[model samples]
Target chain A: MIKIKSIRNKILVWVFLLFLAIWGGISYATFYQSSHEVEELFDSELAQAAGVLSQFASVVDLSHPMIDPKLQKDIYGHRYEKKIAFQILGNNTLNLHSANAPTTIMSNTAGFSDQIINNNLWRVFRLNVKEQNQVIITAERYDVRNELIHEITKNSLYPLTLMIPILLFIIWVGIDRGLSPIRKLAKQIRQRSPEKLEPISVNFEIPNEITPLFSALNSLFGKLKAAFERERRFTSDASHELQTPLASIKTQAQVAIRSDNKDTQRHALEKVVEGIDRATHMVQQLLSLARLEPLTSLDETSDLNLYSLTQTVISELDAESHKKNIELSLDGEESIQIKGNQPAIEILISNLLSNAIRYSPEQGHVDVAIKKVSDRVQLSVSDSGPGIPEQDIKRVFERFYRGQNCQHILGSGLGLSITQRIAELHNATINLSHNPDNGLVVTVEFVAKN
Target chain B: MRILLVEDDPILGDGIKSGLLQDHYNVDWLTDGGQASQALQTDSYDLLLLDLNLPVKSGIDILKQIRKTGNALPVLILTARDATEDRIKGLDMGADDYLTKPFDLDELLARIRALLRRSKGRTTPTLTHGELELNPVEHTLSMSNKPVDLSPVEFQLLQLLLENRGRVFPKKQMEDNIYGWNKEVDSNAIEVHIHHLRKKLGNDLIRTIRGVGYVIDKQ
Candidate 1:
């Protein structure tokens, strides 16, 4: 349940990895290039200092009775900054000209090339004066190369350091601007009431990422609106259904009183009673359908003894069965236990049994059975009467759909539909099959609890 | 009493016209609200039993037209819409009483009588039928207008029978009306009550129809 509000967190995660990769590549490249450039600059500067000092050394006479002061001034003043130092080693005496005026920048050692000074760590280039039987070695402090490297690093790193905050600010603004539409959509939805089913109007310029979500929400609203409209229509139709019969009864009763003949009055009163019965039936069915609308399933969590529920429904139907002489019997598993809504299960069983009895011929037989098979609990009701036709099997589960032949029977045609709906709610399947023994068999099966 | 019934269904309208005729109430039945409304504009009626739904114009509209000119005649709404909302709507539209559809015939007649009695203010202290008369206010009985002594239950039973003369009041409705909602009466309580009432008022005053309830004819 981590709440992620900023899309930039995701963007930053990806961008930061890329940024690190590019920074690493650039840092390595610049480090390589600057170090190479420092080496080249040091080599050239060493060569130039050697060439200038050689020219000055060739003009010097160590055995001269008088060394010209001007020549000494010229040699000493040849050095602008004491980055380069000169030393001449010959015959157990060393002549050294240092940047510190008699102090060498590095201890010199040479044998036909250049060497590093161990004590002072300077760059030293050696030139052998073989004819003079002497070696002239020039040295410079390492500060000249170190200073150049430091300057290059400072120039390269300054802009990179300043860019970190600017990059963060850009990411922040980009994320906020990117998520603005989602925020607007949330506000619009929050302001709406549950009854409002209007589609959400969002910008076409919205990122492809959010378009599918908006369309899905719009379609969901459409379905919600349709369901509400259907419910409202059902209520209105129910009222209309109940109102017609009541009007008939009242009008008939009032009419019956005006007739002077006793026989005519008796007939009128009988008709009025019939109208009342019709009205009562419609009201009961309407209420039952209303209750069934929102119910998804019968409570199927509780352990239910199917035997008890069947026995209760059968007992209730006993009076009718006796009156109709439609021999009703319950058989099969004696103590069948299952998980289901007891009342819903009872209602489904009752409707089946009642319909079987009502539509069955006088003295017909209704066989009800509850049996447990592997991984399934099955309840079957078979009647020795005219079974449903093959084509009408699916239609039987629709509301208010009485078979063409069964119109003579007094029923709202909701009994079987409610049964099917209840079955669907419980994740049970209802199969209507024509019995080979000349009747209908309705089988309801629920998956056996493991 | 004369009654005007406005309804749309021909089968029901004919049935009601005949039922009222048998009850000795002169009923002029109109199947259309427009005809009924026109008829009422010209004539007068003691009571109007109206159905909410009708052809041409609704019963409510007819009632509105009738009431517009200051007519306060008693109106009883007899319709099948039993929802509390519909009942309230019918009553608020100037109906004196409301009865849902599929109501017992005896119950309808009783409501009509109650409405008419209230509207006319016909307060006869002793309500009479045949030779039996019961004084509701004084709780007394009179045979031929002469005072007669009777037990309290017998007196109440005689009063109910006389009040609904010539109509067979079913035992169930009588048991419910006579006894309170919570009172526990025997299964044959109405028969027992009728037995005692008949003994005091004389058996002929309370007639029993087989398979039906009791009735006191207005001979």
Candidate 2:
């Protein structure tokens, strides 16, 4: 059900999907890497600023009862650029310094401590301040680093958001333009009537991938043209061949009507009747051949009992063979089942049998046999009569081709042609040869399904 | 026997007219489709021989018009188109028989006779008068149920006679029903076959109208 008509559309769809996956992956990786990097830089800068301010703690003059405005200015100045703050803890009493530090200081007896204050995340480092036995806790606000990362990420994502609609638009337009030639070809095919079998002449400058499609279509059209020509030629030739005998019959009948004498009139009319019979026979054969031309494939999978079909064909021709004193026998194994189109196989066998019966001399024997090999079923018809010449054997399968020596025989020469076509349709082959004593032998072999 | 011949070609029309005249069938022929349609509307011909392909109107159209008016006239289609679809179409359009073109004159005459015999409702009911009896359903004829042995052809002949027992049936109609539509019968085959039937059924059953044809006159 998946027609391989449009290769470009498939390639474009895959390409667009791959682009989407890769773009998403790269954006996520860069965003995660930059955010982690900003967090690490913020941590290291806070620790270094706390170290620089600890050296200035020796000048604080802690024995003073009240806080010094000079010390506050000194600490605030040192930590101004890095947005750092600190708390000085002495005997469970706390003194906080810096612009944004809360009035209540954190209890930090350990080396370093980090916590959130007033709904703001803070990273605080605890210093011992060994001279006073007081804990020096230093902290920095976290929103500054986060704000920088957010700005950088927002700038990077703006172009990607804008590209989604543009990418989809390009894919749609590319697929439509790529398949335009296919639509043109479909329209060209639809414009043709059944009687017209001309090849498609519309050509476009396209990619290398499209050449195979064009060539495939060209070859199919070529075959269709040839088949139409063959059928038209066959019909006209058959009409010409049949017209002669019909014209003769009409002329003879008119002549009989004009004649006054009874004997002459009766003789002319009798000749006319014979001509009419021959014409009718020829016309029937021609029509059957025409019908066979359009049937290219076989209904080989049907539940066709070949034995019954063979019996029917034999019975149809039984009366003719009885008058000729030729015995038509069906020799085959019971339940010789093979899968093939029944009607074609019947026509194949009938033509061979009729040829055998027609060419055989009076009282000569015709043997029809069927056998099943390991993987194939073989049906053979051998006649005891004058055989086909060695040179003309190949030519007999061609349309309207008859052997030179068999010119005296009553045949239109389409029988073997139709039989060969049927054999080709079934993927079977006809093996023809001359019988050793005097006659011809033709065999059709069918491939077994199992 | 009178037949309405509906054909297109002038030469074939003239030839068939003369040919039917020789066989003692009074032929009123029309060469155009319009004329043929008009003739069927007014005339009481024993049979209608129609060609499938014609100018101004097709044979199928004409046949459809005939059947639409509930006219039970027997129409035989004679055409060059022998495809299965065309035959099915003609028969579906209420044609009694289909004969392809370039056919034998004898065969054509025989088919026309067959259609005429069938048109008279010869096969629809059992015909009985006095000691003579014929059963259309069983296709058997008997004199007082004595089991008269007859060939298939002779049985059909007796049935044709018994169906039209009260009328003078023509010789051509008898040959058509008995010999089929394709067999080439000479002019005398009908006469000879009727003679044979008379011999078997007793000579008093059939009467020969001189210079015309044999007839099964009604008792």
Across all candidates, the chain A TM-score values are: 0.63, 0.62
* Per-model CA lDDT versus the true structure: 0.72, 0.71
Q: Write the per-residue lDDT of candidate 2 for residues A1-450, one digit (tens) a residue.
A: 555455665666677788789778867876898899876776676666556666655556554435554566565444334456667666556654665566687535454555778888777777776766666677776676667777777778778868876887788787788778878878877876648768777867745666688778778888888877887766655754565466446745875776586975786677677676766767666776777777867645565555667778888888778878887788887577767677677877788888888888777778878888898877888888789878888788877666756644556678898888878887788998777876898888877655
Candidate with the greatest TM-score versus the true structure: 1
lDDT of 1 by residue, A1-450 (tens): 566555768777667777778777777777778978986776676666666766666677654324443455456553334456566555424654553323432334443234455444566776666676665666666676666677787689668757766886798788889888889888877866658878888664678898898888889888888888877655665665656666567657666665666777687788878887777776676666668768865544687888778888999999989997889888887767877777777888988998889878889999999899998899999998799977778899766566756644667667887888778877889998978877999999987655
RMSD of each: 13.7, 16.6
DockQ of 1: 0.19
Residue A338 of model 2 has an lDDT of 68
Badly placed stretches (over 4 Å) of model 2 are A1-24, A48-99, A107-112, A132-137, A160-218, A241-268, A283-393, A399-410, A418-450, B1-219
